[model samples]
Target: MNLRQKIATGAITLCSSTLVLFLGTWEGNGQNTVYADKLARGLPTVCKGITKHTSPDPVVVGDYWSDERCAEVEHLVIEKGQLALADCLTNQAIEQNTFDALTSHGHNFGMPSTCASRAVGLINAGRIADGCRALAKAPDGSPVWSYVTDAQGKKKFVPGLYARRLKEAELCAK
Candidate 1:
């Protein structure tokens, strides 16, 4: 209509366009969106390329965080394939390592007597990550488990149950 009104409208349009472009490019950058769905609130955000270990979230059930970067590492395992990733994820339990939480569960549940078989059957064949991603994030938009953040940050587990699983996967190349 008027010159002033037209100019203001044009300015608004330009600003909106720029904002949309900036946000699109910034999406998922330096962030781990793979497990964003599994992240918990009050915990840190999972980025794509910045794994750091500096959060207060504890690993628990419904926690994608295992004090081990299972989620992040899982991607590699998955890309490698089901059978191989299963071997990697369950290596600790198979060895009867006390650190593997799954081992205890496996012994009690009688899934397969060996953690490796159980892991392979459940994760590779059954697709545990698919299920986990749905329920791992917090209500406040943070990670449920601290490990997811750590995984996103590229932190590895020490030489223990979790570490063993990851190491096994890395060694297996699957």
Candidate 2:
């Protein structure tokens, strides 16, 4: 075969080999029809459990935790009619620079902007509001602040403002 044809053949063979191996492994067990379920749920499974070898970003334990934390709070507000998510997230904001830290850690989705927006959307769409208002305030009576200070010592807290997605949306509407 020509060089190009040989390369194509090799690529196809490698992909099929990987697929066959995956089909025989834990994820591919006949229990849930893994491939079918992935397709149905819109879950990405092109690389299965394989990491950098295939997809550049592989889901990790930390990713799951972030998702779980967010989901748990959302669920509590939406399903249980509980306001604890606000308190839980209040502590989360103060203890962790959650939004910025998550962004710096290459976790864009974990940022409060996105999560807060989603939470609010859920609330507006018949789910509970989840009390994101409380999250924007620091425990020490100061608001959760964000802004750039000028060299002249001008501090701006954008008073009564929220750096959250849902709150931003709400404000924008008004």
Q: How do the residues 47-112 of candidate 2 rate in per-residue lDDT, one tens digit apiece? A: 122222223344233233233343333232222211212222322212112222212111112234
Candidate 2 residue 117 C-alpha distance from true site, Å: 19
Whose TM-score is greatest here? 2
Error of 1 at 172 (Å): 19
Candidate 1 Cα deviation (angstroms), residue 111: 18
lDDT of 1 by residue, 46-161 (tens): 43211222222332323333324633442332222222223345322222122122322222222233333433444434454322231223335443222423445764323332
Root-mean-square deviation of candidate 1:
21.9
Task: Please list the residue runs of candidate 2 whose C-alpha ends up more than 4 Å from where it truly belongs after superposition.
Answer: 1-135, 159-174
Instruction: Candidate 1: list runs displaced more than 4 Å.
Output: 1-27, 30-38, 49-86, 89-119, 122-174
